[model samples]
Target chain A: MPAIVTTGITKSFGAGETRTSVLRGVDFEAEAGEMTFLVGPSGCGKTTFISILSALLSADGGALSVFGTEPNRLKSGDLVRFRRDMVGFVFQQFNLLPALDAAENVAVPLIIQGVSPRKARQRACAWLELLGLGAHLGKLPSELSGGQQQRVAIARALIHEPRLLVCDEPTASLDAETGRQVIELLREVSLNPERAAIIVTHDDRIYPYADRIAFMADGRLTHVERPDPARIPARPIRGETQP
Target chain B: MLGIALKMLFGDIVKMLGLVMGIAFSTLLMAQQGGFFIGLISRAANTVTEAQGVAIWVMDPKTETAEGPTAMRDVELYRVRGVEGVRQASPLVQATTTLRTPQGRSSAAAFLGVDDASLLGINPRFVVGSPEDLRRPDAIALDQLGFSRLWPGEPLATGKEIEVNDRRATVVAITEALPGFTAPVIVYTRLSQALSYVPGGRNRLSFILVEAEPGRDPRAIAQAISAQTGLLALTTPEFQRRTIDYVLNNTGIAPSFGVVIALGAVVGILVTGLTFTLFVNDNLKQFAVLKAMGLSNWRLLGMVLAQALVVAFIGYAIGLWIASGFFDAVNQPFSDLKGFWLPWQIAVMVAGATAVIVSLASLIAIRRVLRLDPATVFRG
Candidate 1:
């Protein structure tokens, strides 16, 4: 089964004359073991769609499902649990708290899972080590380079081993090389047959990292394209699971 | 989760101090000033405090305060003595007179007369000559506080001489006596000598101090004395309360302290309210981020309360310590702050008030945060 499925989803803001539709009757789906890129112009509904899928926003109508559970059917508490246990998020701002060191920031998800603090920190350290950040585990977000900070954000998102990861313009603030490194890290560390990752970006330079790039405009999904490995210089996938 | 909340609270060092200081200042001011007010009112009853062996007081019907100099006829003492349950009745006199300084300067002095045989009303504590020295001819025992008030530069000695009511008098002893709000210069002399020093026509007895016999109720004896003698007879505790009540009602001291203490609480609330709201605004985005991470609203409320508790505990502890330190520094036997104390009742009251102030400030900020959409982070 697909990791996420949205059928005729609709979301709007304001009332009467000032009313505007941000997402209008959109149907979209994302599969497991793949990185799906959502892209379009700035005012397109890319962020609105990503927010709805991340369970941060409620859809005005239609059905949405993640891991075969329809979100609209879940109560508020169950929805919170679903998001907590199954979904993770990465932000463009690298929203790692400046007050916490990299390891502690990554440990937040496990802490929220009611894991013991010592064990959670140990798991966080292990994850940071896997990403080559063992020497910088104690550095705060402000003290790290852009690529390292993004790596910490990715570690935080994957720490609880959530099945679906949604990233919003994750490389928007980094330079080209750092952005490439961060995208490669996400691709290397997150995709698997039982899990999926989504990146919403306007950076065409990172397009080769996605298995499929979906185009959005005027709150509607218009097209999706798969890159040809024989044609593009994009690194071909070597495995279906995280290393 | 609580660790994150605490880290957020303590990381902002400047604002955390601002919050703690606001509550601490209010607590300190309320406790310290309240102690002084209590001390001042207690001093209004200094006459009753110094008369140790007497349990009942007989004064004129119209006398309302402890320091009122309503005189009674000399025969009234015998009448009070005849009351049932009265073990020993002493005719006591408390009157104000003037002492003439060597420079011809005059200041009002409190003239106190005791029973010549027993000296029952004299303060037992003395710093210079003994109590017997007060019995010599034209001899007087002036309190060290009075000596200092009457002669600011003079040394406390046994031989200083002053003129009372233009008559020759000598300070034969220096005794320890707490200065009262009404009478700062206290002079203890014999009843006959005070009669000469203070001029009163036909009525010289200021009060008939009575001691009830053992196994007898003083209140019943006081009532019988009042009914038989047509004078106001009151137990010591009752008279002390009346004096304190007089100070509270007739003087503005009670309301004045009340206004200051009330202002302290209000200022505490305002300081915390403004700063906490500002802190919330600065961290609003972070709250949205937390909410987006699926932290339930209930858990967020817990985090807010945890922060408030931490601030309240630190602030209240420091405020209490500083007030205690200040009281220890200034409290002395004869100083203005004598009998001053930060009572535990007042401390508990201040603590309750501090909790209220802290809770109100935190709840106001939390209300705004709870209504925010976690999706707001998507926009910013």
Candidate 2:
């Protein structure tokens, strides 16, 4: 079964004359154990579609399911629980809280789930150790470089072990080499038979890592294709499971 | 999460200082003004409070306060003394006169003339000399503040000669008395000398200070005296309360203090509300990111409340410390503000006001948070 499946997902903003349609109808699917990249020009409704898929937003009209559960039909409380237990997100800004150290920032999800803070920090430390950030765990986001901050954001997203990871423009702020490294780390640690990852990006340098690429323009998915396998780099997998 | 909230608030030093200062200034102004008002109003009843054993005060029906009395005929004293439950009735006179120091300086002074034999209404805590010293010829007792004002550099000692209403008077004792609202200089002398010194009509007795029998209720005795003698009579507490009420209702002191206190609260509310709102707005994006991470709106509300409470508590503590310190410094001996103090009730009142301030500010700021769209995090 697909990890996420949506048909005719629609959303709009404002009212009366100023009503702007950002997502007319978006139909998309991603199976478990695969990395699907949504590629499009700016304002193509790519972010809105992922937001709907992850339950960060509600669709004006659509049928949506994540891992056999339809989110729109769930009660408000149930929907919040679903988002908390099943979804993870990474933003383009690497939005680590400026006041918190790296480990504390990465510990946010588990803390939100009501885990003891001491244990959350322990788990966060293990994740940081796996992602080559063990030396930077005590440093705040502003104390680290762009690549390091993005790594901390990725650690925060995956620390809860959610089945569906959604990342929007995760590498747009990094250089080519560091961006490729982050994507490599995200896939090696996040993909398995029980989980899937979806990344929204306009950065073409990381395109070879996507198993399937969906193109969006003008509020709909225009095309979906399998990328050439030869262009993908083969590297030994590391940090495949929770440390 | 609450821990995170506190960390967030304390992380910005300049903003935290601004918030603390707003609350502190409000509290200080409120407490200080309230203390001053209480101290000043209490002075209106100082004579009543200082008269230790006088249970009932008998005056002319038109006399409302202790400051200015309509003199009753000397025969009215005998009438009050004949009332049932009146153990001892003594004639007490209150008058104002001008005093001239040996240095040739002059100032107005409040005069109290007690019964010469019993000295029933002249009870005072002596500061420098014994009460026995007032028994000497032409002797008078001066309040410590008055002595300091009349002789700025002179030590408080006996054998200081002064003139009252052109009559020679000597300061034989220095007594500690609560300063009055209008006159800080208080002079205590015998009834014969006060009548001889001040120019007045044939009626000389200002009040009859009646001490009720041990088992008698002072209020009942006062009522009996009033009914039989055709004079206004009141228990000590009643007279004190009436005096304070007269000061509050008939004077501008209460309104003046009230305006200042109201302005302090207003300034505190405005400063704290605006600064707190700005603080939240600056961190709005961070809050949105938390919301998008599956934190419930309820938990987010709790976090905001936690931040607000922390600020209020810290600010209130600092303000209260400073205000109490002011009261302590002024309450020293020889200071004109010797009787002023910060009451715990005022602290509690300021605390309640602080709560209202923070709640209003948090309500305004949290509306923005509650209405925030978590999807906006994706926009950045």
What clash pairs does model 1 have?
A: none
- Candidate 1 chain A — worst ten consecutive residues by lDDT sum? A234-243
DockQ for the candidate 2 complex? 0.73
TM-score of 1: 0.92
Evaluated at residue B220, the lDDT of candidate 1 is: 97
Error of 1 at A110 (Å): 2.1
**How much of the real interface does each model capture, measured as fnat?**
0.35, 0.59
Task: List the candidate 1 regions with Cα displacement exceeding 4 Å.
Answer: A230-243, B97-109, B127-130, B147-157, B167-176, B184-187
List model 1 lDDT by residue over A36-80, tens digit each. 999999878888887888788889998998878887777888777
lDDT per residue as tens, model 2, B205-277: 8888989999999999999999998899999999888889888999999999999999988988899889999
TM-scores vs. true structure, each candidate: 0.92, 0.96
Candidate 1: give its CA RMSD in angstroms.
2.8
The regions of model 2 sitting more than 4 angstroms off are A235-239
lDDT of 1 by residue, B1-380 (tens): 89988888887788889889988888888778777777778778888888878899899988888788588888898999899999999988888878876767666767889989878778877888988998899999887666766677667777877898778898899877766667666788988888888888888788888989999999999999999999999999999898889889999999999999888889888898788888777777777777777778888778778888898889888888898888887665444455567778878988998899888888888997888787777674
DockQ of 1: 0.59
